[model samples]
Every structure is written in structure tokens, then in C-alpha cells.
Target: MKIVIFGGTGFVGLNLAEVLLARGHEVTLHDRSPLPPAAQRSLADYRERLKVVQGDITDAQGIDALMAQGCDAIVLGAAVTAGDDLERASPARVLEINVMAQIPILLAAIRHGVRRVINLSSASAYGAAGQRHRILDEETPCDPVSFYAISKFTSERSVARHAELFGGDFLSVRLSAVFGPWERPGSVRDTPSLQFQILAAFARGEPALLPAPGIKDWTYAPDVAEAVALLIEAERPRDRLYNISSGVAWSALQWGEAFAALHPGLECRLVSPGEKTVIKLHGGDRAPLSVRRMADEFGWRARRRAPCSGRS
Candidate 1:
């Protein structure tokens, strides 16, 4: 398969690209930044197996050219993630990257007869369900609380519309906190409260900060990439949206304790939830999404363990 991936240098994208490349698929990565030396070296090892193109999604001509390369499928993973302070953020740019950019690229994909698209949506779109104990499925009502969520939700809707009009298969994976290797340093990695605390402490050789006692699921990036691969290869396409996450839930304290156990030499401190700015995590109480739909239809499962689970 010839796969064209948007935002391929980032954490999730890089993991997905590696998976696809290993499976002998032709991979082309489109991104705004020049490939880092490490990424360039990795791709170089693949020779003709991989290609990286530097282009802006906002540029219609550039997107069109890439789409014209006869990609079998497109994966939209580019976006300005959450954690930006609204005061210094450009809502226009945010919307441009998340929502507006999809228009031209998707249209070009359709024009070029691309077969499928897997859009990376966010769980944040469900908003502060705050102990509502609601199970958020594909049909869950969207109450986006932040600009990032709003943009992602709008983009998913836009992609659905394009899929309907253009006669191409589109799948939206509403992802939870995706963590693993190749993590970039920015809002995408830091926005999650637990990760923010872990990364900060790891940087300083201190303990991670824990959130208030609450349950949440964190999906590993490789598992997410595997789920995406199955979605791409499914024989019978189903709903346009699916929640990709670990069915199990863990409290913030559990995560910290687990991490401390893994690296015994690291000093661990559990901070009171009161010391942290409290933003309600959107999806915790919901019953685990039945992978039966994906399993029966496409044979997808959570293939990776949680970070602190101490399971390889």
C-alpha cells in the first residue's frame, strides 16, 4: 500500500510510519518541518521504502500535488494540540490547521481517487463530562470545552461530510491520551495532566505530580498505530467514529506509584490535587468501548500495555 501521512514526524505519526514501513508498505510523510537528523537517518535506512515531503497543508497546490502522487490512503494526524493559553494563541491558525486544512487535502484525495482516510480526532471533544459516569461512544453528544476540542470535532464532522460527498471511506478515531516513545516536547505531550507532571519530574529527576483521585485510560502509541492499521485494512467499513483507548482505567496515584516502582532510584512525590490547576478530564467513567465491533469487523485490539502497568 502507498500511504501518505500528514504530520508523520510527530509521536503517533512516526510510530505509525514505522509500523507501515515494516509491513513493506510504501510510506510518504508530509510535514511542515524539515526531517530531523534522526528521522532522516531512519528513512535513509529504508531507501526507496520511505519518502518525506516538506509542505504546508494550508497550501492547496502543495496538498494537491501530494495527493496526486497516487496514495492508496491518507492519514490526517496534523493539528495544534491542546494546552495553549487562549490569550497568546491564534484561533485562526488553530482552525486553519485542524479544520480548514482538511478541505483541500481531502478534496484532492477524492479527486485523485484515494480509497480511505483515518482522521485522528480527540476525546477532548466530549468536554468536561466531570463524573457524569457517561459512556461516550461514537454517538455521544459533543460538548467541546476548549478551542482545541472544538476544532477537532469540527474537523471530524467536516471529514464525514467530505467522505459522504466524495464516496471515500473515512474513519475518525477519537483518541485518549496517547503516550509512548518518539514523544515530542510540546502542548501535544504536555496537555495531559499526568504526562505533564511525569515529563516535568523526569526532566528534573523528581517525582511526578498526581491529579485528583479520578479514573482515566491512556493508550500507548503502538497500540493506536496497530488499531489504525486494522481500520485501514478492514473489509467492511462500519461507523465513521471509534474510541481508541485502553479499556482499563487507573487513578493518578496508581500511575505515579507504578512509575516509581519501575524506576526505583527516581525520587517520587505525590502532590495534593489542590496544588494543581484542576481541569476536569473528559473521559474516565465510561464503560470500556467494546472492541467487538472492530474485532468482528476488522480484528483490532489494544496491542500495547499501559506505561506504568509494568507489563512489556
Candidate 2:
């Protein structure tokens, strides 16, 4: 199969691309940014199966053209993972990319007769509901407070509605806090992963300062990629909305400590009351997302082999 991932240069996009390529599928990564050097090196072995294109996600014409080139499936991975700072600085741009830009791509996919469309949503879409509930499922009512959350929820509904109206094989998967390879600070993604920050701090010979345990149902990027691949390849998924998550909660401090043991100069510590750290948590830790739907339907589950155990 031939697949194209919007925002393919981003963290999860790159992971998904590698997974698809490994499965013997041709992939095109269309994004506003060029492929990072590290990702380029990692994917060098699959050069024959992968193509990277630099273009704006909002360009309807470009989307149509890409699909016209014989795309079997399309993954909507472009998004502005905004926080309070970015929301305040550029709210419209956030909506433009995360919500409004999705319609054009979906329309193009439909027109080109793409077999499947997978929308990569976020667990942040749960927003306040995530805080209120200990477990979030597809049926949970969402009360998104942040612009990023609002946009994600809106995008999910938009994709679902499009599928309903056009009878297209389109679905949305709400992903939990994703952290793994190819994750780096970028213009659109202001919130860097705790793991990234910890490794970075150690590299600078400074302790990884944390405001709290930074606990949540963090999912690995590779697992997420595999689950999404399942969705795209599934003959017909039973539900329009699903949650892709680790199904267990863990702390950043635990992960940091495990890493510190391997590195001589590394340190991970809690911040003192008056001390400030550049590391920013995405939001107050929320409850874990339930992966029952994903697991039951596709027989997929997150790999919990990371040292970050399910300890308070």
C-alpha cells in the first residue's frame, strides 16, 4: 500500500513512517518542515520506500495532488500542539492548522477515493474531563478547556461527521501523552517530552528539575505507530472514535531515575519551592486513557517494558 502522512516530519509522524516502511509500504511524508537530520539517518535504509515533501498542510491543491499520485491511505498527523503560551500568542494559527486545515485534506482524500483515513487526535481533547475521571474511554464526555484540546475535539468530530456524510472509511484515534524517538522542540510543538528534557539536562550537567511526578498514561511513539497502522489496514473498524494509550499511569521521575542510573553525570530531582525550571508540564496530570477498544478490536496494546513502572 502507498500512504502519505501529513506532518510527517513531526515526532509521531516519523515513527509511523518508519513502521509503515518496515511493513513494505511506500510512504510520503508531507509537512511544512523538512525532515530532521537524525530522522533522515534513521530512515536511510528505507529510502526507496519513503519520500519527504515540504509543503503547507493547509494547501488543498497540494493535498489533492498528493492523493492523485495514487495514495491508498492518508493519515492526518498535522497539528499545533499548543499550550497556554502558544494559545495566547497565536490562537487563530492553532485552529487554522489543527481544525480548519483538516477539512481540506479530508475532502481531497474523499475525492481521490482513498481507502482509509486515520486522524491522529490527542488525549488532551479530554481536557477537564480527564482531570475529573480516573479512566477515559471513547464514551467519556469531553470538556476541553485549552485551545489545543478544543481544536482536537473539534477535529475528531469533523472527521467523524465527514465519514458519516460521505460514507468514507475515516476514523479518529485519541492518543495519550506520546514520547519517544524523533521528539524534539519545534515551533508548533512547544511542549517537549519529560524524557527529552531529562536527557537534555543531563547532557548539560544539570539536574532534571520537575514540578511534580508528571504522571499520566504516556504512550510510546512506536506503539502508537503500530496501532495506527492497524487502523488503516483494518477492513472496517467498528467505531469512529478510539483511544490509543498505554492503559497505565506512570511518573516522569521514575523514568528519569532509571535513565540517571545508566549515565554517570545524570540527575533527576524535584524543584524547590522558589526554584524555577524551564521544563513545563503539558497540564496537571490527568487520568489514564482506557485502551480497551484498541486492544479488543485490533489486538494491540502499548509496550510497558520501559523502566517507568505503574507506581503512583
Candidate 3:
């Protein structure tokens, strides 16, 4: 299989590229930014299977030109993720990157007769609906609240519409709270998981004063990449939309306690929901996503986890 990822140089994209390459698929990473030195080194073993190219998904002409090279499938991994200051920032860019960007890419996929396409949608599309429902599934109605969530939902609709018009096979997978290796604070996203903050705090010898210890399902990035790879390789997808998550809602206290047990020295402190902290977090109720669909269709489930990494 020959696969091309639009935002392939980013954290999740890079991981997906590696996973696909491991599965014996040729991968091309198309991104505006150059591949990092660490990534280049990390994937050196599969260098022949991987091609790192430079292109911006927002540029329609560039996308057309790149799609000309041809690929077995395309994965739209390009999006500007929301950060801590999401409400007050990049309102236009959020819509532009997440919503508008998919138009040209899907059209080109149709033009080139690409076999399959996967849009890496976000679980945030559940939005406030999570507060209402216990578990989010493909059947759940999207109640997008944040700008990022709205864009993702809009893009999913756009992809489905394009697939219908072009007679294409496309799948949109809503990813959960993913955090793991090759993760970093970047221009696009910050480390949002309580597990990550606890690990980093312990490493820095700082108090893990996490904001709002509410329940949320956290998926490891590696597991996410693998699930996506399988979806990309699916000969006949059972559904157009699926949720890739841990499938279990874990409270902050539960995760923090696990972290403490792993590293007994550092304490996990939880600030009250209304209180202020270095990083603002929500202590609100959460809806865990069901992975039953993915499991039932592809025999897929996340085996790895959002593990605490600080060790002696």
C-alpha cells in the first residue's frame, strides 16, 4: 500500500507514518514543516518505505500537484488543534485549517481515483453531548461546542458529501485524548492530558498540581496511530465514522493515583474546579467513547495506554 499523510510531520502524523511503514506500506509525509532530526533518525530503518515531502494542505494547487504523484490512499491528518487559549485564539485559522483545507484534498483524491481516504477527526465533536450521554458512539449526535470541534464536524460532513459525489470510499475516525511518545508542546497543540502533566511535573521535581480531576478517556498516541493504520488498510470499512479511544472513562483521581503508585515520591495535587492554576483545566463530567464498533468491524482495540513514564 502507498499512503500519504497531509500533516505527516506532526506528532500524530509522524507516528502514523511509522506505523504504516512497519506494516509494509510505502508512506509519504506531506507537510509545510520539515521533518525533525529526531523523527528522521527514528525512522531511518524504514527510510526507503517513507518519503518526507514539503507541502501545505491549505494550498490547493500544491495539493493537486502532490496528488499527481499518486498514492493508494490519503489520510487527512492536517488540523490546527485547540490549546489552553482556544476560546480567545485563532478563530479564523481554526476554521480555515480544519474545515476549508479538506476541500481540495478530497477533490484531488477523487481526481486521482484514490482507493480509500481517512479523515482524522476529533472526539471533541461530541462536545457538550458528552455531558448528556454516558458513552459516545458513531450513532451519537454531534454537539460541537469549541471552534475546533465545530471545524472537525464540518470537515467530516464535507468528506462524506465529497465521497457521495465522487463515489469514493472514505472513513472519518474521531480520535480521543491521545498522548504518548514524540508528543510535545508545539505551535499547534499543548500537552493536555493529566497523565502527561503528572509525569512532566515529577520529572521537573514540581508539584503535580493538576486542574480539575474529572473523568476522561485517554488514548496513547502509538495505539491511535496503529488503529488509524488498520482503518487505512481496511478493504471494506463497516462504517463511515468510528471512534478510536480507550473505551473507558477514567477520572483524574484514578489516573493520578495510578501515577502515584508508579512513582511514589511525587504527589498528585488536584486544585478545585473553580480555582486557578498554571494551566486551566475543566473538572466537568465526561462521556467515554465506545470502541465496540471498531472492534466489531476490524477486530481492533487499543492495546497500549497513556502510561506514566517517570521512573528511577
Task: State which candidate has the highest TM-score.
Answer: 2
lDDT of 2 by residue, 68-119 (tens): 8889899999999887888999999999999999998898888889999999
Q: What's the residue-level lDDT of 270 in candidate 2?
A: 86
- In model 2, the clashing pairs are none
Per-model C-alpha lDDT, please? 0.72, 0.88, 0.81
Residue 182, candidate 1: Cα error in Å is: 1.2
Off by over 4 Å in 3: 272-276, 305-312
lDDT of 3 by residue, 1-312 (tens): 989998899878988987898889999999888999989898999988889889777889988888898888999998888754754667888889998989988999999989999999988888899889988999999898878888899989999998888889998999987767667656766546666666677778866776666567878788899899888887898789989998876666566767777666877778766755564453356688999999998888887543444321
Clashing pairs in 3: none
Ranking by TM-score: 2, 3, 1
Q: In what order do the candidates fall by lDDT, top score first?
A: 2, 3, 1
Better of 2 and 3 by TM-score: 2
Scored by lDDT, model 2 comes in at 0.88
Clashes of each: 0, 0, 0
lDDT (Cα, tens digit) per residue for candidate 1, span 1-312: 999889888778888987888778898888877667876776676768888888877889988977887988889998887565641467677788889988888889889998889999987777654234445666657777668878988988999998888777887888776766567656433354455455556667655654454456667777888888777767657788887877556565566566667776764445564565333343345344435456666767676544465421
Candidate 3 RMSD to the real structure: 2.6
TM-score of model 1 (CA atoms): 0.86
What is the alpha-carbon lDDT for the whole of candidate 1?
Answer: 0.72
